[model samples]
Target chain A: MRTPLCDRFGIEHPIFAFTPSEHVAAAVSRAGGLGVLGCVRFNDTDELERTLSWLDDNTDGKPYGVDIVMPMKVPTEGSSLDLGAMIPEEHRRFVDETLLKLGVPPLPEGEGREGVLGWLHSVARSHLDIALAHRPVLIANALGSPPVDVIEKCHEHGVAVAALAGAAKHATSHVANGVDIIVAQGYEAGGHTGEIASMVLTPDIVDAVGPDVPVLGAGGIGSGRQVAASLALGAQGVWTGSIWLGTEEYRSLSSSAGWETAFLRATSSDTVRSRVYTGKPARLLKTRWTEAWAQEGAPAPLPMPLQNLLVSDAHNRINASGDPDVVAMPVGQIVGRMNQVRPVAEVMAELVAGFDEAVAGLEKVRG
Target chain B: MRTPLCDRFGIEHPIFAFTPSEHVAAAVSRAGGLGVLGCVRFNDTDELERTLSWLDDNTDGKPYGVDIVMPMKVPTEGSSLDLGAMIPEEHRRFVDETLLKLGVPPLPEGEGREGVLGWLHSVARSHLDIALAHRPVLIANALGSPPVDVIEKCHEHGVAVAALAGAAKHATSHVANGVDIIVAQGYEAGGHTGEIASMVLTPDIVDAVGPDVPVLGAGGIGSGRQVAASLALGAQGVWTGSIWLGTEEYRSLSSSAGWETAFLRATSSDTVRSRVYTGKPARLLKTRWTEAWAQEGAPAPLPMPLQNLLVSDAHNRINASGDPDVVAMPVGQIVGRMNQVRPVAEVMAELVAGFDEAVAGLEKVRG
Candidate 1:
């Protein structure tokens, strides 16, 4: 499992797990693979700082990274409140009507949702600032290439900056902007993604950026065989996100939305790229919410921060309601493989073992 | 470049080139790789037999194969004329209007378009019968799993049956149906394809169907590095199509429609998956014709053979016009990399060299 990327990142294996839960992140790092904490769920600097502190205290000195949603250009610019205001009234009404029609109940009294809407540029910068204050070994931008200054600032901190690129051109631009790592995310990946698939995107990005920069293959990757395939595609490692969501560590997290059962029941065809969450194309488990948004005559989703703002409350409500039919969760097509909930350590072990078997099989074919 | 698949097919390299032109197909077979003659363009059994004869005469003693569009399911039943009758007048009118708006001139007076309407099940069966009569070493179904009788018939002729699958389940079904080779195609592939990208689909299918079933990686593969990546993804060989379009041998073919210039000028991003061609998701060059169908008021494409029937006449007109911007050529995203035209032998040599370099590069990364 050891490759140049593993040695470069000081991790025992090249498997990089991306998750929103601090517990899963620390657990993955403790298990010898790099665990990247997704910062999009952190709505404020204080919450993010607490999460980082928790990770630092729990990982037993193993290296981990932080992932933030920082696109090259955002649809709107202002405070979270101002961005909320920019969301069209019709869009807001549509969200409300759709949820009401779905029989989604309101939150308990005084249980208002609050956080640094991660898609907002201001919030993303705040996340970067808080992440820099922590001891993370790397910082990854989810949507696109990080701004030049962000990359420079990370370099100054002796922390590497990784950007998710869905195309070769995007990877080339990331490398030109001094990005240390390029995560070639395919259309099957959760969160924002491009039309390109990971199989082609990984090699395409690796070729575009040359061999000097490390490329991590992401999207629809759950098993060790997939990890082996990623390495075969010229990726230094595999960047996995959806696989962690079904792990025991993630399930035990306080923020767990109780959608593990839904994930367990999903097939590869259960996922769809819908813009209901962030006004961007993201693969998610097909649910009533996604279906409603896709219905004919449904209001078109607003771009970026506006859509995020409009749906932020609805997302919270849906999760809080624990309605399996309407709970919106970002997941990849690999959700089909997450049939059971296992400890993060066990998942890591299986990934390594599967990778070994796949490699051994390929070796036999080569012979 | 030697693998078990190459030995099974008795080819020098693991590259399988699929082309509609007999000249290009024969050239590839003569160049040490298995050249698969696409039989979709052959309207009748006589034409297919003649093309196969031409290939047999030109390739010396080298082995070649045949590729036909035999989807497991057809939109309509009965003969080709019955399927043609099922096409609605509105759909026919839309196609005529769309082509008229694009200024796609009809073929010269008394010059009628000819070819097997590949989507027709009857036509495909006739193609299969013709191909089996010849001595093709392999028979590849372009869509879905080949019928049990089709696979059994191929086995009877000592011809390996290969089918293209875009998902793990599709591959599994193909293997269960006794397909000898599973061509795991990604979204970036030309012709009909699914939403999964090659990066994920190849590995997913490879894992699902197990090691005994040899998987050939397809879609967005043009360079030696891509071939290396395909091997890494657990594919025994790489199945390529769009790359062959730019070869000098194809350009010199008597059947060449002069679309080589369009392919050479296109970039990777210049391709999109649209249903305009065959009522199925297929990657095609983004041209005025595709853009026209994408407009807001454009009619939704019909299903399968119906769409094929409606557009067959329009397609003939567009190709006859030789207007590069309106030609509906099925191509992969890798068309961007086909910037120069070269002899099939030269292209084959570069692929082998590029694959060797890529393997050596991966070895460096492993060290």
Candidate 2:
């Protein structure tokens, strides 16, 4: 489905997918949608730089985007011990005991824990610098609107800046800060989200930001029919994330051990929004880890960055354990529909076709 | 827009409007949509019988429906004292202190608490009996699928049975229990909702229940574009509730006292799902009253009828106090869109026109 955003971004459709894997991002761009690569998962700035360089060569010259998360507080370099001191003894003990209870084993030799360093704004700014040096068409910040100077810098690089807003007021603030696009992320979304659902949030942001600004409907959208529904809610496009986790390209790069199976077995009701994941309320696959955190004796989740740092080892061990039922991953309620592992190209075709059928079906009812 | 449901119900459109006021119900039916009057509010059997008689006489000979909430446990006759004893003294004291802190005065003399009686299953059964004596074309249960005998009883009375479901498995179970229609009520819904959102839940339930059974998309639906989006997600019709809170007809039948004003001022995020309202997590206008229940020292909300029983007097006091910011009412996220108070006729016409525009707009993107 073509919207004004399609022409502006020089893409075939207005589907903007947020993913961490460069392969998935490149495939989305090749499939006629904009692929936004999330940078916070990068353990090293050099690793992210090399990945972007690879995406630049492999996307067939098609435009893609990069996403960064600006943490509430930045961590000073070489301060791991200091950060560790911030966590309580009980909270650390609880996490370690939880790993032991779950029968999770330690990571193999030389495998470093992907701790909270990527969550720092300073690291995200370096990601922006590396992204700008590449041939990307758009940039998005996960937390909110990037600083006005950051928006202006992206503008100077001939790139558009997009921001995710969970409320109408936030959308207005993002627009005022020179954000070119607003992704109305609802409470049903994976990762960090606010309380409004996409059905209400999209139209509210669309009205609040006015018609000149394109709003992409996010949260709980998986099908082409949902893509059409997004456009129906006054959004000019759709900002998708969770569906990409089940793609063949993603499995090719990442460990399929517990990740893909977790999504395949999930129902819409299986995901829960909890602060235990990222020290912020993010929808994640419900598992023994999440259930244990909700138990009466469990300590309250530590604030962001620190929470991630405390549990990074546990998450790494859980991933290494290769148990499908207890591995932690951020996913949306739309996991119910991601039952199959398919190529990104096949998934993209189905979405477009589904949109076509949905629109045509509505026509039959327009008496 | 004419779905198969329109022909089955002999209605002009597939919009099903739920309201507690019969006047608003009649107006919605007159405006060519199905108006389902909520029956749980009537305190006495005679009062409910008389209201249904009025609906039978009015509605201009058009069809209408009735909704009942089948509580978890039926309260025996003359057991108020036993139920009162079930609540802890500390919880009772907390409620009293919160009321005093908010300056909510007691209700006028001779005006009763409305107590846990209405939440009793026997009361709901009486509501159903009176409803069947009237001419309602449909009967809906707010909880899960009604007992098989209850569904059979409605069928014997020549009325269709509709049940609200928040998950796909629930929809399937309802269908197995012979529920004629399924209302996929998502977390964004006003009262007693599941964690799944309408965007993902609608399609999942639609696929689960199959095409033969009509599925109504509920939660955060206020405009015609949203109705179209619901259809795109494969709902045969839309089950709308929150938008009716700010309607002209409802305002005429009931006192405006804080009720309509609370909805008019809300911004989507001004609501929370708390068990304090009904002992079940129902989305309500977030207020100091609701906020207090969530604070540290506040006692945990009691289950089911106990929670409603504990707060009945307090609810009465708060409603009578006429404070817009502190009123406890069930409303969906769509309250953000209900900025203007309009007649049912105008709202229905706008929904129809909006649906036309949305469907047409999608046609433009088909190329």
Candidate 3:
């Protein structure tokens, strides 16, 4: 059961669980594998700090990590709107009108504005800085390579820097830029991914990086068989995201509402990549919102902060309304394979057992 | 514009054209790119030999290659029938009865008695042997790794050995087992592919294998921008299959009428992977016959040789009947983008032009 990843991460297994909830992360770490808390859902720095504290109190000193979004291509130059400027007056009016028609009230003027998507980079960095205060063994940058400062800071603190890459070029960039671990994410992975299947992506990343830097295979990994396949492909470990959403820890989150339940219930055919969430084309359960945006008459969404700002309120309204067909919940096509709410610890156990069984199946043929 | 692939393959570009028709392959080679003849349709030694000879004569000394189907896993083994044997007698009877009811006469007994799919490897080997004899610069094995002997023979002849890998692990196997180049094919690629999508697959393969083994990116690469992106992601070249189907060279042999014009017409969603072709799930245009196999009471098709044998005659019947709904044509999702009918040379020119434009687009952003 031990692997290079387990040895490096000092865990029983190299399986790294990714989740929006700190509880899930704590639970997974306690169960022997590492869990990285997702930073996307945290409304502010304070919220992230509280989550870290909770994780610290609960994990009994088991090692866990923090996952943040630091896209390689940022709106560094040009008059990139700072969340507020990106949201058009017309777009806000449209959302208000639509929500009013749907009988949902807008957040009372200044009330909800306090914790809205303010400065994504700042928020992520703030979370990272605060997380550094905790006993996290790792810090993962999702969507792209981590910033040089972040990587340097993590290394300075003796914490490992992990970065997610959808392609070998990105992995090369991560390696060159000093990432200790690379999450070779496939397109079958949830969230923002460039097009590349895991099977083709994993081994290439490993080869491109040579034997020095270890890669954690992410995307569409649910079972132990998949884990075994990842390792067989040369990845030192597997990083999982969608699998956690179907687990008991994630089920407790309110965001795991009607839409996600439906997404978790559907088959692989149900997911679609649309610019409905975060302005980037990402795979999510196909919903009426995405379908509506796909129509000819709909406005072409802007990039990054603009597009994300344009639809942030609409996404909130949809989630609040419990409309499965309208909510923008990030997920991969693998969500279809997730049917039941299993415990994370039990899921980890099954993954190990499943991996053994898969290896056995292959060994039978090999013999 | 300059990559090791272009230098090694002796082409103006690193695009390798995949075509079922020898004429198309010859034309692509003449137009300054490598043209690879797909050998799946050549069912026997004689047919493959004749096709290879024709390609040799027509290529005009321009570099060209031959691609053959050699799957990584066989559903049936030597004994106990496996999946193929488990295919019920009733299902075979149903296919026979359906053909009879459709008023299609069977092939004359002993006229073309060799099983349709069983001879693929042997037939492909004959083609490879012929290609090597003619001193082709390259030879490709589609679906999976080429047989160990095939790899050794190609190496002995100083011919570059290329294998299509749908995942990074498969790519690693090819590299480790001594393949010179890898075609990192995505799910959007035509023919047999595992479930991983291309965007994820390409990068993973690139990373796993390292830059030492140059990868030819495949799947959904119809335009120059995609080719540029492939290069950007660490692929040395692009292997395009579906883009050439609508070219004038291909249209000349378009005698099949058992498929819909829409299936022939381009749309990304037109193709689906079903077990209707070669008993292995492959992406193809959806047709009534495919639907029939998936209907509520449909019988499971026999694996490979048997299923291919069962349908070859039926395809002839459907073609003769001029019903497009019943025809099974291998295609990829990129077929939708291949709308215009043009000369193969013209297509090559457009691709290079498109690549230049894409590079320009990126440069503009960079500036």
Judging by lDDT against the true structure, name the best candidate.
2
- Better DockQ candidate (1, 3): 1
Q: lDDT by residue for model 1 over A1-367, one digit each (tens)? A: 7778777889999888999889999999999999999998777689889889999999999999999888776445877776777778888788889989999988899986763378777788999999899899999998778888888999999999998988888888888889999999988888778877775677778878998998889987888767766776688888999999888888766343547768888877788898877888888899888999999989998887778778888887887887778868888888877889899999999888877766665555444
For candidate 3, lDDT tens digit of each residue in B65-96?
A: 87877764433333223434655788777776
Residue B42, model 2: Cα distance from true site in angstroms = 1.4
Candidate 1 C-alpha RMSD relative to the actual structure: 2.7
Off by over 4 Å in 2: A71-78, A114-116, B71-78
For every candidate, the chain B TM-score is 0.96, 0.97, 0.89
Please give the ranking of all candidate structures by lDDT, highest first, separated by commas. 2, 1, 3
Pairs that collide in candidate 2 are none
| Regions of model 1 farther than 4 Å from truth | A2-4, A74-76, A254-257, B73-86, B114-116, B176-178, B254-258, B363-367
Over B175-219, each residue of candidate 2 has an lDDT whose tens digit, in order, gives 998899999998899988988889988999999988899999999
Model 2, residue A133: C-alpha shift (Å): 0.9
Per-model CA lDDT versus the true structure? 0.83, 0.88, 0.72
Clashes of 3: 39
lDDT per residue as tens, model 2, A107-218: 8898856575667667788899999999889999998888778899999999999999999998898898899999999888998998899888888898999989989999
DockQ scores for all predicted structures: 0.41, 0.85, 0.05
lDDT of 2: 0.88
The sequence of per-residue lDDT tens digits that candidate 3 reaches over residues A1-367 is 5666676778988889988888788889999899999887676678788888999899878889988876655545223344566566766665566556555555556544332343266666777788899888899887677778788999998999999887777789888888999998876888777655565567668778998898888876877756765665567788998888888887667653776567666665566777767777787777666666676655666766567667776766676667665666778766756878888889999877776664543332222
